[model samples]
Target chain A: MKAYRLRRGAGRTALYIAVIAVSLMYLLPLFWMVRSSLMSAGEIFLIPPVWIPNPPRWSNYTKALTTIPFGRYFLNTMKIVVFNLLGTVLSSSICAFSFARLRWRGREFFFALLMSGMMLPGAVTLIPTFLGWRAVVPPNSYLPLIVPAWFGGGAFNIFLLRQFMRGIPLSLDEAALVDGASYPRIYAQIILPLSKTPLIVVSLFQFLGVWNDFLGPLIYVNRERFFTLALGLQMFIGYYTAQWELLMAAATIVLVPPVILFLLGQKFFTRGIAISGLKG
Target chain B: MRKEEAYGYLMAAPAILGFFIFTLGPLLASLWLSFTDYSVTNVYKFVGLANYKRLFSGADPFFYKSLGVTLYYVALSVPITIVSSFLMALLLKQKFKGRGLVRVIVTMPSIVPAVAVATIFLWLLNPDIGLFNEILRALHLPTSQFIYSETTVVPTLAMMNIWTMGSTMLIFLAGLENIPEQYYEAADVDGGGPIYKLFHITIPMMSPTIFFNLIMGLINGFQTFTQAYIMTEGGPNNASLFYSVYLYREAFTNQRMAVACALAWVLFVIVLLLTLVVFRTSGWVYYEGDRQ
Candidate 1:
């Protein structure tokens, strides 16, 4: 199709124009976010909205963090994030290894069955699960938020890891089996080492999910002591509804980490997304 | 073989057990609880469809309102995101300088958490001082109340969602990549123009991805919560009372556990039926090798 392709002239310029135009539509709002974050409260609502702030207010970040016990919230969020990340990575990989590498009766059947579990609305399980946990633990407990990771992480995560694991050369694992090495040993020493890319992808996804999760913390933790960044920002919304500068600052704080994480893991993120979407 | 089988079960036990306990058990329990008036007191009486009856019998003020609001959101947002993201993918598929940077910028919003996106949009959509209104005013275009206005809430929310559809566009890009080169070559040989190629080849090949995005979009859209819950709180006389919000308020705020359970089942069924309908009519989806 190179014979007919728009290799030059107005068409190439048109593609460039379209690309830059679309890119701007996404970037402009975020640019506004930073601008608003740096603005003084009075300036936030100025007519024709101030595009550039003279001497950007770096104080807003400090004030935003200090105003709402955001430090405590960050620590609280990190606790859930760390534990959830650990649980998800460990459990989901083990499960995926079974599905992808191990041959067993009803393997394909059970895998399909688990994948179908994604269709079940979280709402269906949400109430009963809450009741179960509330009965077992006190309010404001992180158990409800963290324990789900220990189970199987999530169906999607398991499927992702399994898909990645299935692509590994079977000969290495088969040689271990031929040498009478146990399945666990093979998984631990060979399969896990070989599956680092998907592992990172899964962990990054899990980190972002737990970090950004609002409803879980909302339903589970009622106290200020238990609030994650999401809940804290939510509470900030309530408290600083009129304070646009602080609101933008708080929102930006919550927004930045995940974007940084995505940037750091861009390659893996694309591959992970591609595999999950197309393979599904 | 038996040893291997046992090991497989052992390895997979956590997920399987978790599934039953967290997913399957609750699914059954929710179904059962939907028939009762269970509350936070941990005591209940089986109301025998009273809750569900209340839902459909015009007794529940929020039921229809929330459903309509969410469907309006889903209907608008799903298609908008699908077409826009597909177009984005198409735009990026062409060779261009700085396309990599453009790809990063396009996908950046998707990485932003929902709450943050809502906050940004809240400021951007603020009738008085938001950037959007400023732009609209500058362009001499009519500016509405955005998420604040009852009439415009759903559309505005839907529009904001389109901004963060980077993942959906990536899926489309992948689908675009998978199209056999020979088909495009053959079309070129037959003097088929780009427009003809897009209609005859590209759309058919992409139907499955489009379908996938549609179903997933609907499922996710119907559950629109974080943005609306944080921004609107089902306010402005309940114009933006999404079903998920209504359900959450019913369960947590109102202590209507059984009713919420019923709501959950209703969502499941609606999604299930929609998925089935899509699948049933998905004759346009061109699966490679299926015909042969």
Candidate 2:
């Protein structure tokens, strides 16, 4: 009995050490990033290296902001994020309702096609899509980014919203229909209200994706003034490649808004992803 | 069903229209472009199977070499990520202190932008005075000339991928929670040890999630680009030259649109075949609620 008790105690201690060790491996890069960002250029490369700065260069933040068109990039990113988030949430929910609650011609066939889009690598269609956009849209604007999202470009969002809509009992939609409500009215009053969780999930996901998107802005927005935070960060690296401190400081600044928003809304983020993933 | 069908059609119209305009239409367009010697200059010119012939015949050494490098990455990354996440998930499943904080910190990296993650990793892997190399030297270990050395560049990039295992770990955690305690309790009653319980019960039950994560990880690994783009730019003697990175260079830098389109199609075919293989194997997976 004493041997068994000792074995258990040893096992517990080992497990605690392992977990703490692994967790530190994950945190070390982040810690190093912030630490380096606060040091001066020469100090960043100090031998027997400095884990913490003797005097943190808080001015690195100001220098980072000044180097790029940080203000304009933030505005551009906000524009894409807000518009894309709004369009994705509303359109996806409506389409999902149609797939879940409403029956229409070729519903299953179309539904199958939409699911197929989930597996379709965006890389495959990227070039041709860009060329097509150049053909149809204005030469240079945020139109390419916002327009397709409005049209339900990727089916994952719609598919997710659809599953959640399906899980809802049919009685609600039927009851509204019996009251002589129009399809639009049923959708607005009935379907929309029940899908609050998924809508937030879809919206949050779209916001994060659009905000951090470098490829889209890189492809469409050629002008420096129209660059997003991602593009600004990219240009920051190009200009400050040698300046490790300044580059990291710039990246940390760029990384702040998304990280803060995610931490604050982590509950919703976790819950939303869990529910959607189960159905997925 | 008829009235409902109409509504369904109405509902799906937006998605369908969007798919055709954005996805299907472009896919078909690119397929045609692959057969021709298309460039931004002429935009179109039929050239038969010349581009594909060049790829298979090793006419473009960089093209074939990049494909090999990418396959190497997938082979190395998928298993490491799966095993790491599985172990971490198992550790996390036990009742422990600071579980919430650990989970939060683990997943924090995934939500951050790829660029942000890449930048941090670049700093971490920097050769002179970088923390990783510094630690090695401090402990009297042989330090790697990372990012600058061709031998270590790809391996280093693969190592950086270890940080983002948080997403898969969370998914594994969710899968772990759903596993009924009765399985382990019954095993314990039968005098099964920890390793025995893990092999006979935990692993078999977790197979479905494991399979899902494996396929997803493989797919993401094959499509890796953002890090290579910002970090090494496929440098240090092309050690980190990933397929997508090469494709980007072909299309954007070299203006070889036809070759780029061909490369993209080949990757699609490879991914599709792997997905099918996983699906076929998934039948053996043991679900808790489903009886044999």
Candidate 3:
């Protein structure tokens, strides 16, 4: 029995060692990012890379901000992201409720059509979508970005929320109806309350999509000042091609907030993904 | 009936309108534009089947080359992702201290914006003075210009994809949880060891999640764009030119909308077929409560 206990202890130790190694591998790049961001450009490319900067240059952060119209881009991204988040949440939840709870004509067909949208490659429609946006909105407006989220731009979020909503009991809706509540009221009160998890998940996805979206901004918003952090960060690579410090510093700033958000909200996000099978 | 119809439309109005204008409208317009010699500057002449013919005939090097590269990426990324994710999932499933934290850390790379992630990785894997090479030098191991090399670029990009395993890991974890503890208990009672339990019970039980991940991964893999756009710009010899990147170059950069559309339709058919294959094969998947 003692020998068996020792064997189990050994197994546990072995497992932990393996995990520690893997974790280090996972974190190495991030460690590198922060370390390199602090070094002078000359020191950054020292033959033996500096693992730690003895005198970390704090100016990289400031230079990164100054190099591009970082403040303007940040504001643009926030504006676009906020509106996109609101639009997606409203559109996806309302549509998801309809698909999941409300009875309708051609419901299955429409549902299937919506699902088919998920299957269509965005590449197929890139040009047409661009031209379509051009036709609808005057060039360089946020309409192209904001309007789609309001419309259910893509069906992934709505479908995910729909699946989540299906698990909600129909009795809630029926009871609300019987009690002289309107469908909208029931949706606003009962369904929305119950849908907090999926709604948060959809909102998070929309936020990430809008916040991180470079392609949309690149295509529609050609003005340098209107660039998102992602596009603005890309400029650091070019403008300060040799300045690893400023670039890394800039990259870190853009990268960190979303990551912090993910870590904090990971549990809810995981629950959403685990349930809906949509994150992939 | 009219009232009910009105309510249904009212409920569905947002999604339908979004779909029609954003997707369906664009899809139809793109299709029409495909039949024309349309550039952003040029008001397009009807050049029916010329672009389509050029694509299949391998007359356009970009079309064929990008298709090949895209296929290569799909082949490399999907399998590597599946195997690595499965292995990592297995490791996480084991009882360990700080398992929760480790899972979260592993999932971190996925949520970080792709552009940012690519930038960090681009620096980390830089040929000179990059940490990856430094480690190799310190250990007296060999390393090369990974991202810069044509031969090595795709595989390295695929390796970076392992970080995006949070979504898959969550699925695998859920699948692992759903696996009844009784199966393991029975295995133990029958003198089964960890290996036996893993092979006989864990895999079969996890097959559904695996299937879901497999299909979704393939679809996502085929549509891979941003990484190619950011990391290599499809090249040191066009080695990393993914189809979507190629399509972008065709339509926007080169103003070859027709050819790009042809390529997109091909991709659509390919993805559809792959999804169908997975669905057809799902019959073999085992479920706990399911009966023949």
Candidate 4:
């Protein structure tokens, strides 16, 4: 028994060492990004790479921010993200609640349709969708990026909320129904309140999706005035290819909001991703 | 029942309409447009499969080249991601100090914008003063041009992909958790060694999650665009011209709407067929309470 305990202890020590090593390897690039963001352009390309800037140039952030109308981009992204969050949460929850709680014909068929939607590659519909949108709204508008969210959030978001809703006890809704509460009232009160965790998860996912979305905004918003953070950063890099320090600084700034959101809601973020894997 | 049905339809109307407009409508429109000579200049005429004929007849080698690049990316990245993520998940599944912190660090990369990732990697892989080459030189190893070299471009992109294996790792970690501990305990009693337990028990139980990752990874792999768009732009003789990137260029850059639509349909069919093939061959996937 003593020998077994000793072996188990050694095994744990080895595991810890291994984990620490791998974690450092995983974090190396992010660390370098932060470090590089603080260094001067000349310091960045020094032959013997500087692991840390001696006097971390805080001015790089200012320089980077000034290089582009990053303030405008931030606000633009915020506007889109806020609208996306509202649309995705509201629409997805309603759709999911119907699928999860209500009794109706064709419910299963619709749910199956929702599931199959995941299989359709977004690129497949890119061209005609662009044409369709172009025919309606002029190019360089936020409508294309923001309006889709209101339609039904998205198929994945609906699916996720539906799965979460299925785990809720049907008795809650029935109990509310017994009290003469309407379906919407039950959904607004009982389902919404009880489904807070998954709701937050969906919101966080939407937040990250919209915040980090490049291709959508890239394709839609062409005018410099309407650029989001992703597009702004891309354009900035295009012009300032050699400005490594400012580029890293800009990249870091673009990276911060999502990171903060992740840090604040790490549980929901990780759980949401894991749950997606299980269900998919 | 009538009221409930009404409520269901009312709640579902927006999604159904949205699907019809955004998904189904465009899908059908693209199918129609694929056979026409449409450009954004509003000049369109039915060409009766000319675009597709161009694709198949080798008239556009770039289409085939982009397809090849995508295939290469999918083949390399998916397997690498699966294996590495599983290994990382195995490591992470162990009870360790600061495990949560480690998991967060690993998972953070997936959330970073692809453009930012591309920018950072561009500097890191720079030939002269980059960190990677510096390390290589210190280790007395040969330096690589990485994404800059056509020969090394795909593998380099695959390496970048492997760097962000956190999502896959998390999935695998979740899968590992779902595996009941009793199975391992039983194997232990039977004197099954670590390798024996791994191959015989862990693998079978985790097959479903593995299959899930396989499909998601393949789909994502086929759609790789942002990094190539940002970092290389399919440069150095179009080594990194992904299918989606090529299609984007054709649609927006070249303004060849019909060809791009045709490309979209081809991509759609390929992805659909591949997904179906995986589903058909997924007999090896083992689920709890499922008897094969």
Q: What would the TM-scores of all predictions be?
A: 0.97, 0.96, 0.96, 0.98
Better of 1 and 3 by lDDT: 1
User: What is the DockQ of the complex in model 3?
Assistant: 0.66
**What are the chain B TM-scores of all models?**
0.97, 0.95, 0.93, 0.97
Q: By lDDT, who's the top model here?
A: 4
How big is the positional error of residue A210 in model 2, measured in Å on the Cα after superposition?
A: 1.6
Cα misplacement distance, residue B261 of candidate 3 (Å): 1.2
Q: Model 1, stretches more than 4 Å misplaced? A: A1-7
Assess the local accuracy of residue A51 in candidate 2 as a C-alpha lDDT between 0 and 100.
Answer: 79
Error of 3 at A193 (Å): 2.5
Better of 1 and 3 by DockQ: 1
The positional error of residue B257 in candidate 2, measured at the CA in angstroms, is: 1.5
Better of 2 and 4 by lDDT: 4
Chain A of candidate 3 gets a TM-score of 0.94
Instruction: List pairs with backbone clashes in candidate 2.
Output: A103-B4, A103-B5, A103-B8, A104-B4, A104-B5, A104-B6, A104-B8, A104-B9, A105-B5
Tens-digit lDDT string for candidate 4 (B150-193): 99999999988777788788999998998899999999899999
Enumerate the candidates' DockQ scores in order. 0.78, 0.64, 0.66, 0.79
- Model 4 chain B: weakest 10-residue lDDT segment is B283-292
Q: Is the docking of candidate 2 incorrect, acceptable, medium or high quality?
A: medium
- Model 2 CA deviation exceeding 4 Å by range: A275-280, B1-4, B281-284, B287-292
Candidate 2 steric clashes: 9
